[model samples]
Target: MKVRVGFGYDVHALVPERDLWLGGVKIEHTMGLQGHSDADVLIHAICDALLGAANMRDIGYHFPDTAGEYKDIDSKILLFDTMELLRDAGYTLGNIDATVAAERPKLNPHIPEMKRVMADVLQVDVEDISIKATTTEKLGFTGRQEGIAAYATVLIQK
Candidate 1:
């Protein structure tokens, strides 16, 4: 079997009056991530990781932010579409490990749901996906509560 690895990172500004969507689930927060899509930073990172592993380009390359079709679009749809692209490229998911950095709303409590939702969307075992959270100890934009950021690493095989 041929195995490959890829990494992805994403960040979004936080603002009032929008829901905070991360890792495919909404979390209660004073500020939500701002972007053309739902701004699920974790999902976007994972999509990029998978696409990279398959050498199929990144998420924005497949789904352009300039296109109106992605405006306020549910990120889960993009995740599903990304998986299809990988499958078409003859790549199968091996595993994923991801981390979300946020200073508030307590991402740890929501990690289980995030893993479940992503596993379902990718049609993979939940055990194959790992989600982790950190606070950055109040250091950067995420630590200062100005935004949320996520990083993902994935392994794929053919």
Candidate 2:
């Protein structure tokens, strides 16, 4: 079997009147992430990592913000499509480990659901997906609640 690993990072500014989406789960928050889509930072990072591992390019290459089709679209669809791309390349998921950074809304409580949702989307076992959360210790944009950031590392095999 051939195995490859990839890493990804993403961030988005916080804005009012939007919904906060992370790892395919919606979390209640005073401010949501700003983006052309639902702005799920965690999902975007995972998508990038998976695509990179397969050497298929990043998420923007497949889903462009300039395109109207992605506007206000559900990020879960993006994640699902990403998995299809990986499968088409003759690769299957091995595992994914990801982290999210934010100052508020307490992510730990929601991790289990996030993992469940991602696993369902990727058609992988729940054990294959791990989601972690952290704060920037009041040191950066995430710490100040100005935005949210996420990092993901993934292993894929063929």
Please tell me which predicted candidate would have the highest lDDT against the true structure: 2
Candidate 1 structure quality by residue, lDDT tens digits, 54-129? 8888999999999999999999999999999889888999999999988898888899999999899999999999
Q: Which stretches of candidate 2 lie above 4 Å from their native place?
A: none
Query: Residue 70, candidate 1: how far off, in angstroms?
Result: 0.7
TM-score of each model, in listed order: 0.98, 0.99
Worst-scoring 10-residue span by lDDT in model 1: 100-109
Off by over 4 Å in 1: none
- Per-model C-alpha RMSD: 0.7, 0.5
Scored by lDDT, model 2 comes in at 0.95
**Lowest lDDT 10-mer window, candidate 2?**
136-145
Model 1 Cα RMSD, Å?
Answer: 0.7
How far does residue 47 in candidate 1 sit from its true spot (Å)?
Answer: 0.6
